[model samples]
Target: MKDFFVSLLFFGLTGYFIYLIVQNMPQLFTETTTIKQYGLLVYRLIMVFVLFNLGIVSSKNYKRSKPA
Candidate 1:
């Protein structure tokens, strides 16, 4: 049960990060940028992906790992 809520929270975080990136998307195209800025964007995307996968794996494993 606890794992369920935690997984939901992680999913929510992933969604929120994606929302933030999308909301900022236009600004990236509207201005000049540097490699460092693009690198930061890639880093954020990787973090969002990790959070999403963590949510998926934790939910899937909880059933098998539940205490007897």
Candidate 2:
């Protein structure tokens, strides 16, 4: 039960961070009207994906290493 709550908290925080980045994108720069803006978004999304995958793998390994 405790692990479940912790997992939920992690997911909630990740989602909130994503939401924040998307929410203020237009106001972030003055010249975002070009394709460069989309490029930046793609880069950020890929980085986020990689980080999330690392977190998942680390969590799984942690569980596997712990003896019940």
Candidate 3:
């Protein structure tokens, strides 16, 4: 039960973060130079990677806490 809640919380926060980024995407792209666009692309990729790894680690820990 606790593990389920923890995973839910993590995903919920991740979703919210993504939502915020998407909501601000137009502002980020409006009249931006090529360099600035590339920078935002890289930044978004890093954020996704970090969030994916966080979910993976959280699941691993949750599994480890359970016995066979």
Candidate 4:
């Protein structure tokens, strides 16, 4: 019961964060110059990679702490 609510909150926040990122994605790609556009592209890619790894790590830790 408690665990169910906690997982629900975690997933809800993750979904909201993804929504915000998708909402701002166009602006991230809309730089005036080509170089700036590529820079933003690389920045976005790195951010995605970092976020993905962080999610994996956190989920692994959560599972470890869960009761068998």
Candidate whose TM-score is highest: 1
Candidate 1: what lDDT? 0.83
**Is 2 or 4 the stronger prediction by TM-score?**
2
Considering TM-score, which of the candidate structures 3 and 4 is the better prediction for this target?
Answer: 3
Question: Which tens-of-lDDT digit does each residue in 28-51 have in candidate 3?
Answer: 655654776657667766776677
Candidate 3 runs further than 4 Å off = 32-51
Which residue pairs of candidate 2 clash?
none
TM-score of each: 0.78, 0.57, 0.56, 0.54
Per-residue lDDT of 11-40 in model 4, one digit per residue for the tens? 556566566667767766454447766676
Residue pairs clashing in model 1 are: none
Residue-level lDDT for 5 in candidate 3: 65
Model 2: per-residue Cα lDDT over 1-68, one tens digit each: 44444555555656765876688687666754667666766766776676566557656766766779
Please rank every candidate by TM-score, starting with the best. Answer: 1, 2, 3, 4
Which pairs clash in model 4? none
Q: lDDT scores for all predictions?
A: 0.83, 0.64, 0.70, 0.61
Cα lDDT of model 4 overall?
0.61
Candidate 3 minimal-lDDT segment of 10 residues: 24-33
Q: Where does candidate 2 have its weakest 10-residue lDDT segment?
A: 1-10
